[model samples]
Target: MAIETTSFESRGERCAATWYLPDAVGERWPCVVLANGFSGTRDWILPDFCRRFAAAGIAALAFDYRHLGESGGAPRQIVDVGEQRADLLAALAHARRDPRIDPRRVALWGTSLGGSHALTVAADDPDLAALILNMPAIDALSGANVEEKRKRAGVSRARTVAITLRLVGAALRDLSRAARRADPLYLGVYGEPGEAFFTDPELAPRFRRVAEGSPTWQNRVAARFLLGAPRYRSGTFERVKAPILICLAEHDLEVSADFIRAKAKGAARVDIRTYPVGHFDLYHGDAFEQVAADQVAFLRAHLGPR
Candidate 1:
């Protein structure tokens, strides 16, 4: 049950991570570089899941994105998809070179934005063995639009576009300010008082936890992410070459079916499992523990002999 833990420098960043590997495993172990949630840090969650993967005899690497958690970057909680994807690549490279890992069997287990990036990355890397997307944030704009699908939400699409563009501009302005190490949250961390994604029921508790624990939740995402997201998902659904496993939360206001199926068009294989739970349920509670077991079984059946 005791796996080795360590820290390393990657991507010109100081990355804090843990390596979970069971004793008596084969010489070349398959490794997984777990990507954290979009607005969350690795410390806030994933350590438990990392342990589960380790007990399954899979070496797992859990790390913070550059601007979050123990990783090095500032305007400390900024979100940049392009840079984080690069960080994922750097983490993968580090995992592949790990002495206890097998490069040929590298897999990605990503949550939220990390999940989508994992899918997009694996799409181009045909050597990737498999992918596990846990309540992934496939497309922010699309997921945000799903609410409109049911309740009209009384929102104007043009207004959405305009405000989003304004936010993006604000984010750009912050980046410029950050060049001189100025405080980015001149207005406050979150976009609006209650207009953010987690303002809904399914995500409120998790959002509260973020407020209590990370202190970074007050950090705002670069508005540019909204613009780049649609482009990143371009051809993503159909270009993936690896087998896919999607863990959907029935009450997950975030992970939408339309998002995953749309991007998985070219994936060699796909499996979708939905649980009667909320977005945060996958991390804790008896339900998630069992889900973890199922995930291990799935990984064992498809990615390993253990």
Candidate 2:
């Protein structure tokens, strides 16, 4: 399979992506629309999965959100969940328009925070063929307890003050930009554990490992995103009419399986699989192979020819 560079406009900004197609052309094949996790670009780990999907005779469209990776936007490294959702929709629209893709059999594959976007999109677009979530970052604020955070990585008073001031400034800047409909304010996407930010330092090393290899990956996001992150919720699980496949990591402390299981209780059809590994482990080694095989099987069962 030869992966081709692709681009699309989302909210007036260009979002970059890659399209992987099987050698067997002419026949319109089912496609998977894949996006990465929090503060992540499509260059991380996504290519591995996209290649596997293409090998399975499925077309894969992996994309980077605007302002990250090869995508286009100002104030680089800002993580806006709503804007990401828009990017996913734009990718979906692009996939549907492609001549080699089967528009009616399009499926969504989202990892970590991207999973939240996948569920939210699937809920509203009932025509989607399937949904796959891998250790999604849902309800991020509710995960860490105050006491546990303190134990994980204690913070100095000076660092605390600095973080507070930075966040306050970011929030104000974000508000001002919104008023004028301008680009977002930027900030480091990761912080040490116990610090008030997106991912803990304990879990932040994964970003370093991924970045060591990917030139497109960066550790930044819009600081104003913190203000709206907690309040944003994907309450569309019940409305997601497509078949759902959730691959959960047993040791993942960020996203709780219990929470997802509870919210998706009303879903029409859901298949939940548990892997005995940490969150990032699922991206490589035996765990990655297992997850890929299972996902291929699931998509084959649901999105394959009728």
Candidate 3:
């Protein structure tokens, strides 16, 4: 596959993007956008997913949300939902204008955090042909609470909640300051640095190696993300007009499965699949291939001829 790297502006925010095309494939093929997870970059993970899409003659573009990787933006490491959505919109516009893609047949493939973005984005854009949610997180209300984790770490609920809230507020304030170009930053995005939560997983030793390999592994997330992201709930699924395929990992420790179950009911045109494995397993194991095959099959069936 011949991959091209580039950038685009969304609401004047510059974002990095990449287009993957198969050799000899014409511009008549449908385009797909691959949205990354909470701690992810455009090519942060493996481009194996893009290769699969390319082999099927589907043009795929995967890019970083601004400030995380190559994308340009202030407040590095912040995972604000609104900003990521703007990036997704920019990516869609760039894909549509590309000479090798069929703009009318464009689709979205989201993983983890991107899954929620995909759902929200698809609901607002009616032109999408298909939507794929691999371990989608439409309900932030469903995940493990920061307070609970702190409690388990020997911190009191009141203290933990208060601490987290303060951090979130500080990060937001930092962003506000940056927007105004007030001065060089003193506090970091994590808002008073401490050990990150990704390292606190229950099965740390077992999955640590692969988890550490994630492009965002060493990167500490900004506290502003928790505060900046609109608290997303699955109730909006009713507005999603595109066909959706929801893939869930049965043993996911990051987000609650029940939240996904509740939201999957919103979309009248929805298909759900469950895997016996955990969250990271879907990214690089037999389950990954199995789920990819299912996703490609679903996309092909929906986007291809009868």
Best by TM-score: 2
Tens digits of lDDT, candidate 1, 124-221: 77788888988777677665435542343344666656655666666577667667777753333333422343334445566567679765345456
**C-alpha lDDT values of all predictions:** 0.70, 0.81, 0.73
Judging by lDDT against the true structure, name the best candidate: 2
lDDT of 3 at 5: 82
For model 3 the local lDDT of residue 92 reads 85
| Angstrom error at residue 193, model 2 | 4.6
Q: Candidate 3 on 202-280: residue-level lDDT in tens? A: 5455345534554443345654465555456546778888899899888776666667778678786999999998776
Which residue runs does candidate 1 get wrong by more than 4 Å? 145-181, 186-197, 211-227, 230-234
TM-scores for all candidates: the values are 0.83, 0.87, 0.83
Candidate 2 minimal-lDDT segment of 10 residues? 143-152
Candidate 2 residue spans exceeding 4 A from truth? 143-186, 193-205, 230-235
Q: List the residue pairs that clash in candidate 2.
A: 77-220, 77-221, 78-221, 78-222, 79-222, 193-201
TM-score for model 3? 0.83
